[model samples]
Target: MIEERGRVLSVEPGAVWVETVRSSTCGNCAAKAGCGQELLQRLGSGGSRGFVRALTDRQWQVGDEVVIGVPEDALVRGALWVYMMPLLALFVVALSAQALGGSEPQVILAALAGLAFGFVLVRWHALRASRDPRLTPQVMGAAGFSGVPLTNL
Candidate 1:
């Protein structure tokens, strides 16, 4: 499980919206310049806060601290879909165009088209996955009550 500590922003019947700070280890790393996330952080708003709607049965109030987790496999699958799929599409299309004796410009255009299609596919997959309960993060427990069960709260 990948876990992070967050503070509750709001509460509903069976879920809570928690805001977590995006913590990074970039400051200690040597390859900060080569990392895309580091570049995005520098160019973007750099607002470290992120929100998660975590499912939980326990009663929680705004400002409460809690722990949230998602399965590791979920992260791995998501990465593959978001990265590998587009690269694979580009290579396949480029190779196919070359083998078919397409002109240089035609092959380049085909590769770009393939890349765009891959992004569209990814967007569709994301929309469908948004409704999958298995991919949703869950509240592990309230923070600072390691010895107590949440059910007793």
Candidate 2:
């Protein structure tokens, strides 16, 4: 299980809302001083708060600290769905368009169209997958100790 500690923002029946800040990995990288990522992190750090809703039976109150966990495999699968699928779709469509003997300009337009279609499909899939319990984070318990920072995904 991948776990992170956060403070409870709110509580509702069978669910709790927790806010987590994304810690920048750039801080540990040698190239951070010269990296665009470091600049962006400085500029947008406050915008990194992500509100996560996790299902739990234990009673929780506002401002209470808690630990949330999600399966590591679920995180990996989610990454593949978000990144790989779109690239695969783009290549498949572009190759198919080329196989159909399209001209250069036509092929370029076809590739752009394919990319847009891939993004649309990703959005559709995300909406459906949000309801999957296996993919959702769970409230493990009250946060009694500090844990590693959570990813913003």
List of clashing residue pairs for candidate 1: none
Q: Pairing residues by index, what is the TM-score of model 1?
A: 0.82
Which RMSD values do the candidates have, in order? 5.2, 3.8
Q: List model 1 lDDT by residue over 38-144, tens digit each.
A: 77777764546898999998999898889999999999999999998888888899889999999999999999988988888889888998888789999999787
Q: Each model's TM-score, in the order given? A: 0.82, 0.85
Error of 2 at 70 (Å): 1.9
Q: Give all candidates' CA lDDT scores.
A: 0.85, 0.83
TM-score of 2: 0.85
Model 1 scores worst on lDDT over the 10 consecutive residues at 144-153
Looking at candidate 2, the ten consecutive residues that score lowest on lDDT are: 144-153
lDDT of 1 at 104: 100
